[model samples]
Target: MARLLRRFAETRPDEIALADEEGVTTWRELDERVDRLAGALLASGLSAGDAIAVHSANRREYFEVMAAAGHIGLRYVLVNWHWAAQELGYVLRDAGVRVLFTDPAFAAQAGEAVEGLDLPTRIAFGDGIPGFLPYEEFLATGPAGEPEPQVMGSPMFYTSGTTGRPKGVSRKRSIVGMPVDVLALAADGFATTFSLPGDARTLLAGPVYHSAQWMFSFMAFMSGSSVVMRRAFDPAETLRLIDEHAITNVHLVPTQFVRLLRLDPAARQDFSGESLAAIWHGAAPCSPQVKRQMIDWLGPVVNEYYGSTEAGVNTIIAAEQWLAKPGSVGRPQPATEIRILDSDGVPVGQGQQGEIWFRYANGDDVEYWGDPDKTASIHRTGGLFTTGDIGYFDEDGYLFLCDRAIDMIISGGVNIYPAEIEHVLITHPAVRDVAVFGIPDDEFGEQVKAAVELVEGIEAAGELPGELMAYCRKSLAGYKVPRSIDFLPELPRTPTGKLYKRLLRAPYWQEASREI
Candidate 1:
């Protein structure tokens, strides 16, 4: 990271390297700031392989903290800005973060989360907080020069921890004799798959706390590409930014696509994303209808991949290819292997639904920090790792993901995938958002249930419960249809597009003794 930043500073010192609502930072300026921040971290009694917690939203300073930490091998734990005090506290303590950096927006939450903890330092940006030092003021405390003997740093991403505590994904640092640098391997794969040019102008439309966003933006800087970021996602503004900035690449999720397509038709018609070369999306399963709609509007620029925070990019499907294959997540990319294993850990036949496992060609593995038992549970006897997802591969080798194993519904001994039902429901004109899960049933072990949020002014459809059920009955098997439909104002979803199905399902199972 230091080498790449230094190269850009020397050759294209004055060129724009990154920008946000706050302003822009050039290569030379970014390099200088990164050096000073690294110095400050080191001067604060941190060293190689230490951890720092960055609790903030998408902003310029978020990247700065990452860039600084990258130089000195600090593991920067990405704290979800939406996490409650308990959630925040769990991750901070688990990662053993020596210093915590937060923005003014989350000052109270950050303070409350870390209260009574043995934290060494706290730094705040954008505005002053009671118990924290000003970020800009603290940055000045270190010398404005490069730190010697640079070692690579990495970010520790916490899993959703839907059932328990969120586990920090700790990676092994590749040092002497390591055949490949993991970051370079990952960056090269991203650059090649997404067509990121050295002169690439990219738009970061999602929260930086996400692993995909963090990896892609970090790779952009390493590739000498300029990044344009927004503090929050606005559908129309996303389209306008692509045109205004001549953005060559951007990342999004299916929910964002739904919002973008929901914009006034007139606004969408005016957006000629002529400058867009790649529109990469993942992190959630996209409805086929929605994915097709995006492809039609974007002109074959839409790209989708399948992977998780624990596993890196495993498969990528381009817009043109996706139309022919329909719902596949393309073929596995180079240096990645995909395997399907049944409940007993036996290999499943092609087109057979089972747990999806990933193995790095470079022999890399992932472990949950400080939780060897949990880490051991996810890893197979081999080096392969499963994120507890169920999917299968076609004869042509394209992978198709089903619902998460944990989310699979079993009714009357018949297995049902909520994703398939949700996919059907998402296409309903009146349904703006929906989540399908299982509720405890006396007759069967579990029964299918769906909670839906209608589109604005959906009352025009006359509370279409009957129509939604009829719509599902047309495509899905009767057993897969929801036994009951609950109309909610909105579904519980994280900003990154992960549905909090656990929260949505907990209420129904409160009186039951059955395990969900």
Candidate 2:
């Protein structure tokens, strides 16, 4: 097993390996720091499989901790810095996090979350936080040498459950027992498949707490690529970073695409994106209009992948492939089987809408931490499992998602997928963000309803509902247009591009005797 970091350090010592708003770190610097950090984490009494929580925004130290934890055989939980104290505490307790790495910005929430918990180790990066060890000082406590080799560690990410509580997603084929060298080979293969070069530089513009974002950046990092990122995502800054770092790869979501397009013409025009090799997107349904515009402006660098925290990357579509087959999410990756099944669990013919299930040739499966029943519910007779998404394979074998099963509206017995309606509504010039769901109806079991966040400076009131419905009527059937629309100042969306539709739909169903 080759020591990838040390090899990079030995060969290209002065090359930048990581850069954040704080500063830049060279390969040699990063490698030495990781060695010390790995030793410190082990010296702190944490052992293999012990969980450590990182509750900070995107920063270099986050990767340092991740790299150190991986070499020491620990499960590192990437905590959403946006979560409140209660939510943070729930995950901390649930994951049994033995140590916590936080930033000054989130110190208050972290302080409150661990007030009464059994957690004792608390380390803060950047500015000092009360009751927490300074990151630099903590790193100094470990011996300068690299820690002994151990089983590899993996991340345990919590799904942002639209309803109820979030759950930590665990892999059945745990990497805990895998050799670090084997994992690096696999990561390199994955990165290469995405058109990443061995010396690729990746710009992380999204929150790493999301599984896709984590994989895009960290996997490349493991393969010896330098990483450049910022704590928060800014549309103009994102464009600047690409040119500034000569970034070769990046991970983004659909929302970021819309924002990038909305940037002033001057901001968009003064850019050289020649360094970009692949601009990957997923996590939410991207409107064909938005995707096409992106591809037009960025050339064939824009790509898409379909997967979830539970399922991993199942399929991917290149920009050219997407342009030819507009809405398809592409074909399955190697060794992945896609099955669209009807209500009776029978395989549906191609082009027929049904629940999409998957089985991996390597026997990888998803399991929710501490919830056996929840794990069993998503599994089927074979090794197939579902993420509750409804989609179908086209005649050309590309998968197209209709909507999540939970998001489907049954209005007067006619099934309406909100995603289809939302896709049309989002392209409206006046709309910024939108969520379509079902609301209780007297005669009908559910009625299509849309909650829209208007574009900046666009008035939310007036004949907007009628105009939007008229717009939808152009491309969709009468049954698919939202019956009513509500205008909100802002939609409830996470930084990772996931919408909390249940939050908006809950009020409308408070008095109704039904569950969405």
Candidate 3:
């Protein structure tokens, strides 16, 4: 990354590389900041591969810190902006972060999270915070010279930990230096496969803490593409940014789609969306009905991919291909290998449901930081790792995922996947958000249940539950339909729309004296 910045700074010194609320940063300014940050980190007595944590919202300084760490081969952990202090502390201590960076928005949480830790440095940006050094002051102390022996570093992302404590998904990095354009190459390969334009101009509304959002934002900078980032997501503002910035590519989740599509028609009346070359989405299952409507509205730029943080994205489906297959997550391209195997470790036949396993074609590996026993549990005899996702490849080689293995419901010898039910229910006009899970039942052992959050002004009373059941019955099997639909003001979800199925499923089990 250091080499890449040097090259860019020389070639496109005046070009706008990044734009956020504070305003734009030119390539030259960004390059200088990264060098100074690298110097600051080294002066703090941290060495290559040492970990630092950034628990803040999206901003220019945030990327500067990350790019600096990458230049010096230091692992920068992106702490989730939405995490509570206790949750954030678990990840900080587990990753062994030596330096912590935070912004005023999270100063209180950061302080609480790092309270008793042996942290050597706490740097604050935005407004000054007590017990934290000002960011600019710290940067000014650095030598303003490039650190020697520069090598690449990478961000360590933690799982959302909806089911358990967050685990650090650390990818192994080599100390050996690679080409300056290497980051662009890797990002471009994935972008190109999904129809991201060569002259990509991206608007990132998703928080940078998530892996998918980080790739769309920072990777554009690495590739010399213009990046417009918003600190938070707002449905109407998303369209305005894309239109105003003339963005060519975007990364989004299904929930964002629901919000954008639900906007008043007057708001979307002026949205041409013609500048978009691709609108890639992942991180959760999308409703097929909602997806088709988006394709209708956005002109078929809605491509999708399937992969986990542990495994680099493995499969991609273009807009055209997705229209034909409807629910498939494209075919595996170069650099990734995906396989589906049964519980017995036997390869599942085509179109048969099984646990999904994948790895790089060149045989790279990933591990949970400081948890070998947990790491070893996810690995098979060979190098492949399973994120515990269940899926199958269609006859045409497109991958179709089922629910996570742990979330699959088996009742009376029938296997039920909640995603299918949720997909069906999500298309209902009155249902704003929904989660389907299994609740303990003495007769059936486990029975399908749906927890729904309705749109504003739509009361859960009246025939809402019955209407939803009838609506789902149109597409789902009798046993697969939720036996009951409980109304809630909201469903518990990570910021990215991934459900905390365990949280919704826990109460009934414990009360029934069944172990979960």
Candidate 4:
């Protein structure tokens, strides 16, 4: 048996390991299924270090496959189900996926992605996907006992592809020599940092494919925490799940926080999220206003982490700490060393904004799966690697992010961060979401532009833009405030809360000769 599941199955066999919308899966059942699936993968001529792709929504079977792959030495690629056929196909090929597992919900796109590709194995979780093996039947084919030679495996997550085609974020410290026992032990320690003890029950309302969600849920699963998950995030449903399941912790993005805060006053006041001990959020710059509301409503359980798919969680701040240091992402993790460097790679002084770089204590670093040039672009001397985030540390050591280097707008020789404007604009009553970026400005080189998504039933006409601009003027300087505002019914944002700013900014910059 795998080290993780075996220990849990022996001690807490009847405890629920995973609960999706479909049903709950006990630890014993999960252990047995994982063993069989691991056996089947090994029996199908998949050796250690082989790759498989799982393209599905949040489900019990998703973790089952992940656990099975982790027990053996198979790298599991968590595909972004939102990708178009061409984009999906590119990832499948780039990862050299031998077997593809998908949900019936995305059957057509998955099928089109694999069409004429060399991938020979296809397994579907639910009905209605033709030419693919059923998940249950495939599991039944494997041996009932534990697979031999258990080794640790890790996930290879792809970048969100906001800039261009996504690249796989692979760790330089390969998993080939790591044992499952060591892996389980590490997961237990990692979960402890988030206050997730062995008996904690985690609620996963975000997509598991996201690195943060994946780390929170799966690591807790390995540490004996039961997970309650929803297919898609619903504000009311999230509160209900926490109350119903006695959920101890949950992973959320800033966007979800905004939505939850926007819920009816009755709905917000009716349910008490007393069981929630930790509400960790990241993946985007959360508005100070939204986060304050969540903390005020949910007590001080709302914690924040600063990280990316390429760089693991480097900094974290508790709600209390965040209250003291508003707009800060908090201090660096114990094992992380943070450095802010200028454009010439020189380390910047404290309180001076520059590109943020990280150095892991254990010498761990990120690499693109097949693109060495892309990987080298983010690396610097002394084993420091950057995620292109612009941030600075205060004298007290709290990290405050300005924006992504690519998203910085320069107007009349002054640098403006869109996140600062977006954070303030989103606090307005009529605004549901907002995206701020740089547009062509012949005088200032590049001017600030705002794209706002209004609240439900609010029209995008009349004095709303002026009202929003006036609201910003009260809190922002003249250059920092957006020069113009465009109303959209909705902004292009991923489920995980990352805005597709390029999509919003492309049209205005299409005819420009130069790039920032």
Tens-place lDDT per residue, model 2, 20-59, is 9889999888888988898889889988889999998899
413 in model 1: Cα distance from truth in Å? Answer: 1.3
Give the total clashing residue pairs for model 3. 0
lDDT (C-alpha, whole model) for all candidates: 0.84, 0.90, 0.84, 0.90
405-514 in candidate 3: lDDT tens per residue?
Answer: 88888898788999999899988999889998888877888899999999899998988889999999999889998999899998887767678878888887876766
**What stretches of model 3 exceed 4 Å from their correct place?**
172-181, 188-191
Clashes of each: 0, 0, 0, 0
What's the TM-score of every candidate structure? 0.95, 0.98, 0.96, 0.98
Task: List where candidate 1 sits over 4 angstroms from the true fold.
Answer: 172-189, 460-463
Q: Per-residue alpha-carbon lDDT of model 1 for 236-255, expressed as tens digits?
A: 99989999989998889888
TM-score, cand. 2: 0.98
Candidate 4 stretches with Cα past 4 Å from truth are none
Model 2 segments more than 4 A misplaced: none
lDDT of 4 by residue, 203-253 (tens): 988889989889999888888899898889999988888999999989999
RMSD of each: 2.1, 1.4, 1.8, 1.1
